[model samples]
Target: MERGTRSVVRDRDVCRRHGVVGVLVEPRSQARCAVVVLGGAEGGLHEADAVALAQEGFAALALAYFGSPGVPSSLVDIPLEYVFRALDLLSARGYASGSIGLLGGSRGGELALLVGSHDERVGSVVSVVGSGVVTAGIDYAAGRLDRILATSGAAWTVAGRRLPHLPYVVPPELVRSIERDEPVSLRDAFAALPTGDELEAISIPVERVRGGVLMVSAGDDGSWDCVGLSEVAAGRLRAADHPYPWAHVVLEGVGHTIAGPPGGPVAPYGPGPGVTFRYGGDPVLTADARAETWRRTVGFLRYTLPRETADEA
Candidate 1:
């Protein structure tokens, strides 16, 4: 939905009231459900994700965890309580139901699983191109110890302490390729994340989740092995015998950034057609999958967190 659409309401700075930095999007009328939208390592609030659900009649708050004014400098030293605060605030909002849902992509997607599994306040989770285990961010390691010329390191920190994370070091050759403006395959840089027995240590405990789960992934995710990781999460849920309805939607030919553009196709950063933006999937295929993924996400939320009132406009 475009800005100034009569059916919608947008508050560019809802975080001020909540003591967080983010955006709030809602329908003009009362909403049947409430959802918290999250963005990944790229930082800032995910305003578009919130607006997308708002257009579908849910009250969505895109809470900023990092990369915004007054937000954390990096993923380090963040607080899970901030997420809980958002959840509690939504619970108190009369326009929405008592329970809350989470929708996130990439790093946001990884966090969606964490909050959904750990916090009973969350009733459902929608993760796109997210991992089953905690993936590290760039600054997580470099910030602590200097002289480590690594590309990807620990990405998350809570209450000033960093979580145990796996690093993806960019090879020296790839670094040179980047300096020379040559195309270096991202696969060469993405580290081989933990697997099999190692997964037991880092994986999120989905069995503890009190609500339904839905995850989306792509086979050719150049960013990381999301499809493989999603399977790990699905397996965890099954092993735990999670009673809630859950599904891992693996879209073929899509990339790590599976969602559709907020308004239009994202512009290439800077002058040349750079390698950094080399997310897989053709425009048509990704768009079709994006629309369908969101359609099912809304459906999953509706089923899991049905409205206490019957006022869907």
Candidate 2:
């Protein structure tokens, strides 16, 4: 797509040189900044969102951590070093280290927070329906319903060591419902995870993030308590007196799966193979929320990671 006089370009092999699976989108004109876009539990490239961002003049990479060729098939023990390689790819493309941002949704949102907290180079973060703490990994290929539970295994590792994470204690009733292909909300399972001091070990250190943070969540999220989780990170930032801007917005009527470019299909709720996933929201309200959220996200990124002038580029 063309943005003004500049045509946007998509490069599928740029990240491959850095040992990462991703698609890079950028305007033919020098990009203003760099952004890494991540997908949630669905696990694949978010190329559409990256392309949208590129149309807005930023270099955007839709990165795939798992469930893709050349990567782990599931979300188990993925190394943070791989993410670092994505950053390296952007850096090699001439984007300043301080101008790079991270954007993600759902489990991808959790990953964004974790990566931003650990990497000082991240200039900004936008998490939609994400968690503030590390959660156990999901094994999609596991036959038993319980094997796919959040408590099954670690999702990420740093320096080859597993990161401490919150393990969901799934109730037997919920397991039975899931097995029966009944509609089930996992919010209770997430809510039942430990709190207070118990969370200190697994909670993402949002205060350590080098730049602004924008977290958006659905109040009626059926998958997890994202509003509460975003608040936890916001609280950390406030307590630390973080210099950069940070805001958490709760879209009152929506459910999980709220992040994406606006004006797409708005199926607020859906049923998976083994269970009916309850993504709660009125279609009209969800559509409005999606537009507002995307606007704010773009504004937040523009403010935090400003575009470069032609001379600077």
RMSD in Å for all candidates: 4.2, 2.5
What is the per-residue lDDT of model 1 for residues 1-313, given as tens digits with 9 covering 90 to 100?
A: 2344657787765557777777778898877778899887678877777777888888889888888898876775466678877886676565443258888887788888877776787778888888788766545334321122253445555555665655566577766766677644454555676777676767777777788899889776766678877788899998888898899988887655565333435221212123343466656666667677777888888888757643453
Estimate every model's Cα lDDT from 0 to 1: 0.71, 0.84
For TM-score, the strongest prediction is: 2
Estimate candidate 2's alpha-carbon lDDT, on a 0 to 1 scale.
0.84
TM-score of each: 0.84, 0.93
Candidate 2 weakest ten by summed lDDT:
1-10
